[model samples]
Target: MPVRRRRSTALAAAVATATTLGATALAALGGATTASAAEAPLADYELTWGIKQSYRTYVGMFGSFTASEGAGQAPGSGAFTFTDGTGTYDTTAHTVDLAFRGRLVSASAAHHFEVTLTDLRFDSGAGEITADVTTVDTSGATPTKKGDDVPLAKVAVTRTMTDMATTLTTEAGEYLGSDGYAGAAGDPLTVVKKTPPTTEPTTGPTPGPTGEPTTGEPSKEPTTDPEPTDPQTTPATREPSPTASTSAAPSAPATTAPATTAPTKGEIADGTLGWGVKESFRAYVVGTVAKGRVTVSGGATQSAGNGAFTFKDATGTYDTDADKLTATFKGAVNFKGHESGGSYGLDLTLSNLKATLDGGTGTLSADVNSLGTQTKGVVLADLEAKSGDLKAAQDVVTVDDVAATLTAAGAKAFGDFYRAGTALDTVDLSVALSDDARLPDGGGSDTSGGTSGGSGTAGGSTGGGTGTAGGTGSTVGGTGTTTGGSLGGGSLASTGSDIPGPALGAAAGAAVVVGAGAVYAARRRRTQGRSAE
Candidate 1:
């Protein structure tokens, strides 16, 4: 009996120890999880800089110096003052964003004084900054521009936080302050952390104009509508200027400029259209261009009849009142072919283009049937020769408004092409047309009656009869027209047509592969559109 009691006690002690250890581990794990769910403390930072310089040019001599500093993303705040051989400039009194920089231009009284920022950089943890700034002077006796590559100011910055610190050193470079800046050729800046940003509620909005509400929500109170006034003459409802007299007339309500009037039908100048095209292309390039991925060049059109010619880039002009945009684009987009070889171009000619931005921003689109060149070198030829009608969706301009013109069904189709993140829909290219292309006899293809048909060969006669592929006398569809013709009993729109004909020609097999790609792209785009909806 005694032996049994001793064994029992030993077992109970072992169980008790195991239970304690398990409970301790569970508690520790719970504490870790809770700590992880807590928010991290925010870090605040600031930067300060200054500059001074005097120089002579063919025009005259100029001199100036400026100082500025800015607070960093939330929680940190401070000011930097600059004074040296250069004049004193303290931007601490002025508003500073997350960056500390300033722009100094020729003082109104001094024509020679101008500044530029050439090069600026910061090391890791010094906010990891790298930027090159230039000048933007809208008015004044514009100073002759010097090379922007000159280093105007250089600085070494050290950022020290309670838990961590970093120092950044930069090479001396030009100060291209055309944009505005105050800093020396080289300087040292020290930044220290202070109080953290608070989570307190921000102050409420200040009163805008007399009678205007100062609350977050629009007032439910009934109000009388102000009489319409000339947009150009309408004064903005701003806080009364400091110099305002005690007896001021009622303030005008804030309002947007009236929508622009649309161009008269068929009245848009080619130049206006060209400008719009250039703007659209520039916008696309800005958003899409990247190294080793895509490149674009020579978007302008030159003179015609030269064996190698290109059509002019399209132009666009907005009609605010009409809430419509008129534009035209004609050019070639080249696609990189297989790794081994083979590359080609898609020659496009768009005219008489009008679009309604009614779909709002990014919905300014156009759908138009395209005419295909019978020329051997063009990729559109392969598709056109196979499909009776070539379809095109070109979103020309993006603006905010209501789309009212559904009649321009073609334009609506191009809306998706213009929408954001559709750069891949565009084929990037580089080319210089040796000569200009002749405008089509009637606007680069016709879209007269239904069952559209046009014709072309090296010099083939125009007529109204369907001919087998490659067979002379085949009638081609006019631009922007849909035809009901099919090849090999397959719907021309379907991917099953494997028949070889003049359209495919010597490159029939290759055309099949390329045409299939075009079809796939079109289908994928449509799918994406549906999914978005």
Candidate 2:
């Protein structure tokens, strides 16, 4: 009995020491948990943005568009919604990296475009949202793909998640294969952040591994402490529960987009156009045959050394999708010679030239004054510029001597000086685009690569540009309902759509599993403990 009493005393002393030390360790561990909770990882995100409005409106005319990976527009709404978003937010850095699912396709008469957007990276310091973009243009006949992981747009975002307005970058314009896309506005964005979920602290006094009941009151000495193998030592396994830390787990932060600077309607404020009516016509007017001279007025100036005519203060629109240009210039040129008795055999003047490009043809219209007979909007020449014949650079589209044929009306305008369908001068033309404007062809012109009444289709990612003259919307999903597309998209829902989200609940669950594992270990140690004899 004495020996047993000695053992009991030693065990009790050891238990006392362990209880004190475990309390200290618990205090320290609780602090550690609190620190961990403050730095929670991002578990999920919901981001919303439309690519661009006018672009959508133009493409929507091609009928509704289909979506991929379950991304689609809200019913009857122009905004798009993406669910199950996945990404991370860095609290200290105030940055976010995210990715969503969705692919959109649009087409006009003779052209098709496919765009997929993902991997959005937001930097608060830089105040930009950069996304990886991939696109395919079918106008090249082979469905050329470009802009793989391109920096497509600039976005505004900060830690507070305000002002998610977006606009396309010049790179996006290049990705879309048109300068008119630069600085195009998109829908304002919104964010819904998901936090890392913590395991709830178990209720009541944590059950001891030993099946004994505990007093229902808090105390310095725990009845749950097990017998120490040595009086000088406490149980090596004693530790605090993860409950305190998990409960304080923080949530993911919000995301925002930046702003844009441009004319609201994306219209041209000022521009210029350079074109020469015809090389042969100009020479003939100055040659000994007609014995005539050419004169210019009204903002029209001849280039130095008898170059092309340069007309200033141009006003018009450029269509990127259709690769069409509609512009009217301020200028006039007159050719007069062959004077007779109160009559000049050759007298011609062309003014206010208007240029229109539709499908594969370019038309030059002008106000003609032939010997006192005035005519307006006369189709003076038909220009056929082949692909690779025109060069575009930094807001300038250039054509070097494209083939131009005189039209029937043009012959009469010249007092029948030349017959209808006569070979006119090779045409030289150049026009500049304005940085302050965006021309998305919202009822601007019908110059799609296909003829006015030709058949075309909006194609799908796989393939679809086939059907009637108005064409069908290319699609892979049935969610596409034709509410806003220009042509027929039999399977897509076109409501001025936006982007979607990704799934990331697994992140929060992972941390929870870690905390639960620690609790399980504590219980297991207690369960395997042997009672003091």
Candidate 3:
């Protein structure tokens, strides 16, 4: 009995000691969990910009666009000052600058030349804090043809924290005449917020057994089409037997599209076109040509009197060469002022519209005429399409560096709207067609709205050209969208799917309870033994 009693006491002492030690360990672990929660990884970002413009002076007679002696509206002629990193995020707040550095066009008629906008206090912001323009100094001019930067008076700057992306817009009257210039400077500036890239764990092939003997055939041997593991079947990869003709096949129609043909001349004159018209345009906008584009879809409906294809608010015609298509439209494009975005029309004729018979590859050029009634703000009065290389392939069209000119009448009507002689030189377009108008195994359709090989199904507009044309809205700057992307910094930490520390703590507590229960059971068994003795 004494021995049993001693054993019981020893067990009890052991339980108490373990309980104390476990409690201390658990307390330390809890503290550690709290500390880890307070510290997490952060991200950082910065801001930047780029510019796009035309360069030429409004000329007469044939409305020729000549090179300017001073600052040309040409691209790469502009400069950006104030400073970069204007929109940096910190723990407390962000700081930004509202300024630009470029050769600006003045409002004065005597000196219809270009001046620099150095230190022109516009509005700016950083992270959440914003600053307003307070100074203007456009007193100097650069005799050369590129943009020059001029300085302005200093103004008091203030800042505060706000949880919103910063946006910049320079109205016509922002600082054109405030300093010593005549009219507004360049196009309105629009900055877009960039998304940061997220990090993911890299995955690699599983390691093979270290010392296992080679058993199955080598992986290099080519095998016949293997059956899918899942019972479900896809028409694309399903191998059909000769006797499977009775089976309902989904891909049967896809194989039959190779027999299509081109359109007829009657259909072209009567405004009825083949499916390639819409598909080709779709292919261009989404593929290339446009930057910072929102969307591009099929335009208005077609009537019998119109031409072959109808884009938004416009109609088109195919030339007798069977290789060209001309589109025309007129309407209000913007709503800034009576002259800003009203009464405009143009005839966009595309050449080399035919694609190769087998591969669907070719080139498409433009003979765009900027002709129509216009308002005072219609800077793009007339555009005589320049002979340049344009391409069409796989139901898509593309053009690069195609030059044109603005009308002299349009320039004279610039009153308070734009720089009188600003150029409208380059015009570019990219169109990508959707599935309906996609060229079949053969080639594209004929000029008469008829298919060349077999007959193809008509395509519907998927709302390509999604951007609001001529409408006032923010534009994508020359800087890429990932500029202010997050890097490891002091910003709020973001762990997309990581396990939490608190959950681990709770799991540890559960483990302690389980251990305690086991100890109690052992103690009870020893007591029972003592009683039996």
Candidate 4:
């Protein structure tokens, strides 16, 4: 019984020790987890940039036509500066202010000018610098010649130097390195290193060569060495090499490698031309001409034409300071126009052609067709003189109005015929010439009357008159009749002479009466009524 008691006590003591060791192990594991949670994570970061530019001007004509060529050319240049133009991390919005100053390059007829951009900045993180410039005019001045505001010649240009791409690469930790800038006062940059995982020595049963469980007395429990009571000394730390460090150290945390934030030098090519508005007569024309082909955009229509009489590559700068676009087209233009019975050839040139842009409007002026030529059936002459102001007419009678007037005149003439009761078989119509319709020579004759042949008549009256015949006497009864005369006249006149004077007189008078009576009868029978003329 004594020996058995002693063995039991020993077993109890071993159980107590095993339980205490397990509790200690659990506490150490908890501590390791807490230390891991406090460790810091590595940080990696990049920087990027943007640029903008602009221009402005004023230009106009200055004198009288008769004196000093009548036109003045004014040219000027300007500069602008921008600064802090830098990139930021953590998605922050920022702005840079720009300043502009203008200089009058020339104020004479022969104009010369130059514009410069001073100390412009491009704020691209990673330290990149670039510029994007555009010209804007606040001045309302425009281009004119001889005090005349010529129409259809205005030009505004916005040019971008897309090829002006640049890049910048800053040392990775320059701004946030340990012992380096902390960015602001009182806040020192601190780098924390993560703790490595702690592993416990594993416990397991020993196996016999026969692969059988031959545990005689359980092997003695292994005792973990007590953690040193003296505070454990951390490993000595070595300074990190100026270059990247390869050796591991306790005091110095391994650096969180900086991510590369290098700015890329952008590849630059020609940029597309953007006209503020659809080109009108007074809008800028953007295009390229090569070989014999010209591709142009920006006018009312986009056109491509070949076989130009004169072909030359043209280049000119847009002076925003002068609000003028000066271009020289060295190519010759062969144009033909069809008129009534013939066609005319025109040789057009660009002599002193100046363009101005007013807002969205454009105006151009130049001496065209200075030298004329003729081709087969084509006459070359002063086009403006022959065509009489080919410019769109501001005042001209419309076809519709002229037709209305003729219709009204016909209606009036027809009404007059209807009131006159005239059979409209043949209406001779004629237009009376207005006083203004005189010939160029001044004097003019009236030919307004029109004659028409038709059947018609009119009537009128005259005083009425009649004649009567005296009573007739037969020759055989002459002698008997003489008795009546005898009663009337003293006695009848004898057939022969020797009668008394009174008797002779009575016979002669009777003869006269007979003759008169016969003539009256004849007149009465021949009479017919007269008609009015």
Clashes of 3: 53
Alpha-carbon shift of residue 303 in model 3 (angstroms): 19
Error of 2 at 215 (Å): 99
Candidate 4 — worst ten consecutive residues by lDDT sum? 459-468
Give the C-alpha lDDT of model 3.
Answer: 0.23
Off by over 4 Å in 3: 1-404, 408-533
Model 1 per-residue lDDT tens digits across residues 1-533: 00111122222222333344465653563533422332121123333332211111100111122333221211100122211111110111111112223332322112222333322222221233333334323233344445422333333322221112221222211223211112212223432222222311111122222221122112321121110111111223222433374444233111212323222333333321111221122111111110001111234232111011122444554443343444444443221111112321211233333222321222223222222321121111000011112111121122211212122222223322222222111111111111121222111221111111111221111111112222221111101112333332111222222121211223323433344335323543454343222
Evaluated against the true structure, the overall lDDT of model 4 is: 0.18
* CA lDDT scores, all candidates in order: 0.23, 0.44, 0.23, 0.18
lDDT head-to-head 2 vs 4, winner: 2
Model 2, position 426, has a per-residue lDDT of: 55
| Residue 478, model 1: Cα distance from true site in angstroms | 48
Q: Ten residues in a row with the worst lDDT in model 2?
A: 495-504
Count of clashing residue pairs in every prediction: 58, 26, 53, 21
RMSD list, candidates in order: 28.6, 31.9, 30.8, 54.5
lDDT of 2 by residue, 91-201 (tens): 222233444544544433223455555444443334445555565543443345554345566676533354476666767555544444456554566554432233112
The whole-model C-alpha lDDT of candidate 1 against the native structure comes to: 0.23
Compare the candidates by TM-score and give the number of the best one.
Answer: 2
User: What is the RMSD, in Å, between candidate 2 and the native fold over all Cα?
Assistant: 31.9
Give a tens-digit lDDT track for model 3, residues 1-533: 00011122223222333344565653564533422332211112111221111111111111222222221342422222222111111111112222222223322222232223322222232111112222212223312322222222112223211112222223212222111111212222332221122210111111121101122222311121011111112222233543376454556646645633333221121121121121211211121111111111222222121112222222343322243434333221111110113321111122212211112222222222222212222323333333322233433333333333334433332221223344333333333332223422211112223111111111101111112232211111111112232212111112110011111223322332232223223333443333222
